[model samples]
Target: MRIRSVVDVKTSLGESPVWDVEQQRLYWVDSMDGRVFRAAADGTGLETWDVRRKIGSLALTANGDGAVVALDDGLYRFDFAADRVELLAAPEKDVPSNRLNDGKADSRGRFVVGSMDTLEASPSGRLYRLDPDGSLHVLDDGITCSNGPCWSPDESTFYFADTWTGDIWAYDYDIATGNATNRRVFATVDTADGGACDGMTVDADGFLWQAHVYGGKIHRYAPDGTLDRTLDMPVRKVTSVMFGGVDLDVLFVTSMARPPLPRFPEDGPQRGALFAVDGLGVHGLPAHRFGA
Candidate 1:
């Protein structure tokens, strides 16, 4: 696949690229910059929203009216029409060292997120599920930095990546209960190529596409942990990716250019730029909402 830099606005810590199919736009976050951004699929008409805090990830509401964001300190409902963000729940409010990192909605429309040690000072990161009813439940703990979280096309398997460990683990997911069990390593990454695993998305064929931070590449794997293909990216900090477009064939990828080890400029010219990959001949599953 040929990759092209679609968004020129470099991001400090670009992550969480989500495609809004109805609007024909792509949404993403600059985690370290405390910002959210979206643009047309063609990379025109860019728009940005400053949440005034670190935005780890965000998913749209069930009706596409708003977004439930995993901010540095809490979960919020952001409405662009009113330019307001209403606090929904704070899963780690008391833990000042921990910040929301990466998250996504489940097939059942519940928001599940993970947190990470802000300074890598401790393994205090954990994962939680935010129910549609606004209830919070702890799913896992003892993580230093949590990143990718996605599910299989069959909806029976769930995957989560620990950025520091370079391991992407899987669980037997219970869609009805919002529970993930039977944790096992689903895929592994070699950081020598770039960095640890960062973010991910599953295609309609149940293939997992993972962006490798500091790795300068994205890897595609089959369900059984075999590497299917790899896309060598120009940036070392390839933060996250998602498939979006009228047919969900457009692969939108986000990267960073900031203070992380193996920083940008040294990596490549498009280190902090968002990229669009075409002719992949694959489509992604639709994203779920927070409270549909």
Candidate 2:
């Protein structure tokens, strides 16, 4: 299928694109710019909130009252109506080089977030579970760039990526106990500079759609880790992707403008543009906000 450019956000580091079905808007973050953006499904009504701290990822709460934001150092609740930010947890205050990266809420409404070093130094990032009562549980440790924590459609399996390793790992999840096990390699890419898999989503068909950063494409793989399809992108650093739009058929992609190599050209039309591709009538699960 062909992908189309929906909007030009020109975000320096656009990442974590999530579709809020109830509001008919797409919420995403510009990491380097430190801005949170909400745009209509049709790419209009583009409004931005100037968050002073770097936002890693965001998820709508179960009750739909506000959103849970993965900030630079901690998790916070963001009230859309009031436009306010409140702290939830600060697990790594001592580690100045580490910051929250990608996070999402599980089916049970628990926020799962991961951290990484801003300088990409050592593999010290770890994944944590933020309970409803504000308790943090460390799920895994020794990760370099915690990427995706998307769950399977059945909620029985969880997928995660370590960007520096180019390996996507799968874990069996217990929704009741908030536990993960069976950590196995799900997929791997060859290009070392692709930055591994950044963000991902599980389709209704039980397939995983992953954005290959620096690889310039989104890879669709079957539940058993078989390559199904690849959606080409114009930019080299694709940060994340999610299925949005009215019918959940539009696959929205977020990209970054940063290049690790100094020789890469900076000026390009596709760098910070949001892309949409038809997923052949496939639909996605609506994102659940923290609380109404």
Q: Find the candidate with the highest lDDT and give its number.
A: 1
Which residue pairs does candidate 1 place in steric collision? 194-214, 194-215, 195-214, 195-215
Error of 1 at 79 (Å): 1.1
Candidate 1 Cα misplacement greater than 4 A, ranges: 261-266
lDDT of candidate 2 over 114-202, digit per residue (tens): 99988766788899988887888999999878987898898899899988787889999998978988899998765655346789998
| lDDT tens readout by residue for model 1, 19-65 | 98778889998898888888998889999888999899999998746
TM-scores, all candidates, are: 0.96, 0.94
The candidate scoring highest on TM-score is 1
Q: Give each model's whole-structure lDDT.
A: 0.87, 0.82
Return the TM-score for candidate 2, rounded to 2 decimals: 0.94
